[model samples]
Target: MNTQPDAPRHVVATSADADTVLRRLAREGWTARSGFALPDPAWDVAAHRIVLHGRIADDDTETVALAVLAAARGAGVVAVCDPESAAGRALIDDLSRIGAVHRGTDGADPVASLIPEQRALLDRLAAGDTIAAAAAAEFLSLRTANRRIAEARALFGVRTTREAVLAYLRQRQPE
Candidate 1:
């Protein structure tokens, strides 16, 4: 229910890494995930950074990194390699072309920050109300309402308000 989305995710490709990292991260107060397909459920609010294993100075590694990035759509990724190594530097350069934000624990609880107003707006949006109507229901002006929805759009990394609402529902909803 977080009105503002979390930073890039901290994810692993396997539960083994997930397990170990989870334990270590738990000590440091970081939430983490592992072993999931990069399709369907969006991960923007969950994962903050990606920790890649092995030497990431090759085409294969970049391909893997792109997959993870696609899942969360974050600023940048990190690899468990020698940052000073030639390959590592090259990988960094390649990824920097996209963007890189250090996924931090400040984003531990993606749902913890949902404000009532934002949730109400999303509820209206999910209920199929127009942005104008939804805003009016909340006694807000159209511009203000659009701004809030825009936040949801950016936070969920979707192009449309409907997609953002869907992302909100998927995460906030119970299976």
Candidate 2:
């Protein structure tokens, strides 16, 4: 986690966009590496002029990358998206709602791997009769539920003002 107070915040979501950005950085003599996941990879994120990560959720890509790249600008972040993915859409909406600059081809590309762990969680959340109860059941902690559900909302591109899966849970709950 590059939690520096000053870092460039940028996002590269799709493999293509990432390729463009990374190649540009490489052309500029910015050291770059790409893989499915890192195994205790060690690099001073602050020291690197550019960083690239792939196969991450659209939201995570944007939010985390922004946190890394835009740390100097009050936690700046950027996310690239394929445009066709629901998760990508959600990422765009979430970032846009929060005034984050989202860049990429917005043509919808089915970027659906963002919440592989969330289906069961959403199912559990829907089992309760109230928002708070659903939160309790799904997350077992209000703070955790709040955070996770909000992330889910952003990952799924659900159009609710609360930006939480709890909104779905609450709706499913019988009056």
Candidate 3:
């Protein structure tokens, strides 16, 4: 899990609401905590880079949630929402309405743009014709896709070359 130095700060109307958001986040691999001191007095929950005001539960809910989403966007934190919430549903709708395209063939964020170099590397890997070379490229990177490739290779017991890793990824991909 990517541990931010602090939880992104977000405002929620009540402590209960904050807890709800934090609990949901925990389910999705984000850790949350309260009672931290911030430059602003009303900033209660720090969940990534989001500062939340923890007092008004009536009107501030959506604002805080949106702020949290914005912070996630800014911080490169992929905010997975609880599917049960109206807010989550609305966010999903908004993403689709905007023609957002998600590609996770490399275990990277679907919302993020692929770096040109990485895209080139992924193309080779996906083709499976140059597996050894692609795996070599991923091995030298510090990015998460590289880490996932390494982890997937380890899980599949691939140590030979990128070709071997590509085969593993192909076998694992759904038919």
Candidate 4:
């Protein structure tokens, strides 16, 4: 037997009704003393491991979950729900797209690996520059700017440039 001490586990219950989800987690052996209720006053990203459960919908929820996952660093983060449910599947798809939880591919931090030029482009966009204006600032052709934005979107698994920028910023926030 390996005999290594088991790692600490952090759990977050996400649902329209957080209380209900939390209660369910409690029944599954996740006590408040052992885990945490997300969005609660005690919640912190520095926990050793995190397990998010319940339903996730809308951009706000996704954003928060992403932030938490980013804060967890390389520690394990698991989302539990009935995969057959539409909402659950959507959450899984979103998580997979963003590379939040491993799904065969290495879960690398997309924002951290951004090249200098890409970082500059993202900075300009965040500072309220239009794609054309940002490109002009960098002396890049409009086509090149568009390509860069597209690349960012693909890298972050976001559909729009705005979403990519927001995701990057959210991930960059301190825990």
lDDT assessment of candidate 2 = 0.44
| Tens-place lDDT digits, model 2, residues 52-164 | 44454544554343333333323323345554575555544444333323254331221232232244456654554454666655545666455555555654467552444
Question: In model 3, where do residues sit more than 4 Å from their true spots?
Answer: 1-124, 128-171
In each prediction, how many residue pairs overlap at the backbone (N, C-alpha, C within less than 3 A)?
A: 12, 15, 19, 0
Misplaced by over 4 Å in model 2 are 1-49, 54-111, 114-117, 125-128, 158-175
Kindly list the per-residue Cα lDDT of model 3 for residues 6-124, writing each as its tens digit: 23332222446456556555665664423222333343333444332233223334633553444434321233333235553443333322222122222233212223334445556
| Alpha-carbon lDDT of model 3 | 0.39
Candidate 1 at 44: error in angstroms?
30
Q: Write the per-residue lDDT of candidate 4 for residues 53-109, one digit (tens) a residue.
A: 333343435533553454333222333334345544454444433333321112246
Tell me the whole-model lDDT of each prediction, alpha carbons only: 0.50, 0.44, 0.39, 0.51
TM-scores of all models? Answer: 0.39, 0.34, 0.25, 0.39
- Writing each residue's lDDT as its tens digit, candidate 1 over 1-101 gives 54533333232233354345445645644443332233334555344443332223334455445534653453223233333455444444444333332
